[model samples]
Target chain A: MNKASSALSGLYLLLILFFLYIPIIVMMIMSFNRSELYLLPFEFDLVWYQQLAQNDQLIGAARNSIVIALVNTVIATTLGTLTALCFARYEFRGKRVLQGMLVPTLTMPWLITGTAMLMFFFWSGIGRGLHSILLGHVALSLPYVVIIVGARLRSLGVSMEEAAATLGANGWQTFWRVTAPLMAPGIVAAALFAFAISFDQFVISYFLAPVGTSTLPVQIYSAIRKGFTPEINAISTIIILASMVLMIGFARFSKFGGER
Target chain B: MTSSARRLRAIIGLSGPTALWLTVTVVLPLAAMLVFSFLTVVPVGGREAAFTLKHYTDFFTRPLYLTNAWRSVRLGLEVTFFCALIGYPAAYILAKAIKGRWREALLLLIVLPFWSNSLVRTFSWTMVLSDNGLLARTIHGILPFAPSFDLLYTYPAIVIGLVQSYLPYMILTCYISLQAIEDSLTEAAYSLGASRFDVFRRVILPLSLPGLIAGSVLTFVPVLGAFMEPRILGGQQAIMLGTLIENQFTASFNWPLGAALGFIMLAIVLLIMGLFYPVLKKHISVN
Candidate 1:
């Protein structure tokens, strides 16, 4: 009976993996097709990649995405870390409600937040600009940062800080000297997620962006709207490959330096 | 000494940044939108002026807007159901996979789609389902009389696209909760002569409710506001709340109406959360 069940489990695993990944593999292979139809009468060509490289509009969007993601991520991560520390280390009135409010956005739909931010920025007279756009990303991404960092900090006990205080370390010094280094791994992971989220965000960026400034996802959406060019596929493959490399690199580094 | 008073002061000091951020970024903005939604849309060169409840009333009265909103809600439910259905089994497998070799591989495998951009995923799906595309040709080759299926730009295609995009979240959440269940609980059930199905239904299912709730809500809420997949995959008929709101803001040049619609969405979300939380809470085993 156990053997039969185990075999069934393996089948389930295989099926799920196939469903999840087969589309991606198909897209990657089709990216190089020299055929105009974006389908399987395959002729391999590097033309799409070349087109992708030279498109000024695409390049501008990519630069915009990178700059916005980096700027927003840094701000979100710092604020989120501070917020997480407060939630995890202290007990106070309104704490439970505060925690609940912060935790859900780690999973909240982006659409509402994006729209809300768009309106917020409109009211603030940042109705359209890069700085205003960054505000939306920061708002949406901060929730993720807060949740991850809070969870991480909670897992770390406050005993170390207490001991540091006993040895004459002030609260600020104890936090800096004792807790900050220990919380580095979680912070790094939170930062990475914040950055990834900002990098990949579509709905928020779409709503908040000015007429001229656009991001990569926005560019891709517009390109597909115009027509699903083979060049878009090529660009996508590059983004996927690059992110995978970074994720793996982070995994390796965390294995060593972030063993804490 | 004033040590305890100083400690209380320190905690307040520490909490300052987060409190300030939450107030400005979240609370304040939401308040602004709430006020904006109530404003009247007086045509001022692609915008509105003056305060009026017409947007809200028009939104409630108009078949065009409410129909789209209702459809979006239904689609969100359908998408959530399927994600839970498929994701639960997948998550269950990952949760129970052998610890050393297969587990990490399984976990990473589950997360693969997330690493790929959602637009790319949706586009690839379009490739599969489009006429003369992979799926149709394959079906024609085998069935020979399946009537050249037009899956692209249909409701099913949107659901399929949504499920593919959001299932990973469900799987991840479910896997976390399922993995937390102690082996002994199940072992005891087995030792008591419970059948495998009984063990699952009685012990496992009940225990996994929290994760299931987590997964479903994550899948459902955003999907209700989904714009792109329906547009890209479902085409014209796939108009949901997100798409309609987009039209209001961009194509319609009615920011007040769009903002009203946005606030309506916010209200529905809060209402749904209130109504569902208690019912959902009843299902879980509170620790």
Candidate 2:
């Protein structure tokens, strides 16, 4: 009976995985297909990818995406790590309110947040473009970085810092020599998360990007809306693979599922 | 500097930058949106705008906005229902049935797609669901006489795409709750003459409610505000609150109406969240 039940569970899981992955797999396979209509018995070629390289618009958007994601990662990681350290180490007045402030970014729908950013920026003369997109992405990624790094800090405990202080290390010394190095893995993980969040961001970029300037996701969205093209398939395949590789790197540093 | 003064400075130095950034980007924007929602026009470029409730009033007086709002809510419920139905079982099996490395690997596999670009994933669904696409071709190859399986541009296609997009969140949350359940508790219930179903209903269900609620909220809120999936998959059928708001901003350039619609969606999301606050508070505190 147990064996039968286990078999049933395995089958159910396989079905779910198939559902989850088949669309992605189809997209990947179609990217290389020679036919524009995604014909079967696949004649595989890198023709679309070759075209994608020379497509100035797509390449420019991809560059914008990478640059924005990198800058957002640095800003979000540094600020988020510091804020998380504050939460972990110091109990200041209104700390609860400050922490509660992070919830809106996490819980509020991105559509609402994105539209609000557009309205506020347009009204306040902060007008839409890459800069506004950067602000939005950092805000969106800040909470995740804080949560991940804060969890790591909690697990690492305060004893290490105390131990360093007892050994006559000053505040800066203790932090740089002990705390930072110890928290390196978590910080790296958080940075990767911020990078992924900014890279994969769509709704915020969609609203904030001006005409003739957009991120990759925003560009791809317009491409999809305009028409189906194998070029889109090629770019999307690269995007998925890049993110998956980043996530696997994240999983190595952080326990994604749980403390195993 | 005095030690106490230095400690205060340290706290400020640590937390100030993020606090200021969040205030500028998140709090002020939301507050500005609230003000924008009440205006007749965007107050910019010497555009004289006046305060008005007409945008909010239109939501009630005009049946179009009201119906679209209802449609979005219905879509949220449908997507959340399907996610729960599919995700909870997989999470359960992963937590209770599967062993160590396989469980970890499977969880990663399930969640990896969620971190990828959602726009790309939704576009992939278009390829699969379009007429004479991969799905139809596969079906024809097997049955040889089945009618056309053109699932694109339909409500179900949107649901399927969204379900695929958001299912990982449900599983992750459910797995967190399910993995926390002690095996001895199940064994204890069994030894007490409780049947498997009874144990699951009484012990497992109650224990996992927090994750389930969190997952549902997480899924439902975004799905409520989703426009891209609907536009790409539902086509003409995609007239939810999200699409309406997108149209106002992008097509009609009516900022006031769009802001109003966005706040309405935000209110709905907050209302649902408030209803589940008790469960969420406990779960969050535990984490």
Q: Write down the C-alpha DockQ for each prediction.
A: 0.47, 0.74
CA lDDT scores, all candidates in order:
0.76, 0.92
Which window of ten consecutive residues has the lowest lDDT sum in model 2 chain A? Answer: A251-260
Q: Of the candidates shown, which would achieve the greatest DockQ relative to the real structure? A: 2
lDDT tens readout by residue for model 2, A169-252: 998899999999989999999999999999999999999999999999999988888886799999999999999999999998
Give the C-alpha lDDT of model 2. 0.92
Q: What's the TM-score, to 2 decimals, of chain B in model 1?
A: 0.86
| Collision count for each candidate, in order | 1, 0
Tell me the tens digit of each residue's lDDT in model 1 across B100-173.
64776677667756755687788788778889877888899899988877889899999988998998888887
Q: How far off is residue A100 in model 2, in Å?
A: 2.1
For model 2 chain B, where is the 10-residue window of minimal lDDT?
A: B278-287
Candidate 2 per-residue lDDT over residues B84-189, each given as its tens digit:
9999999999999998899999999999999898999999998899888888888998999998868999999999999999999999999989989999999999
| Candidate 1, CAPRI quality class derived from DockQ | acceptable
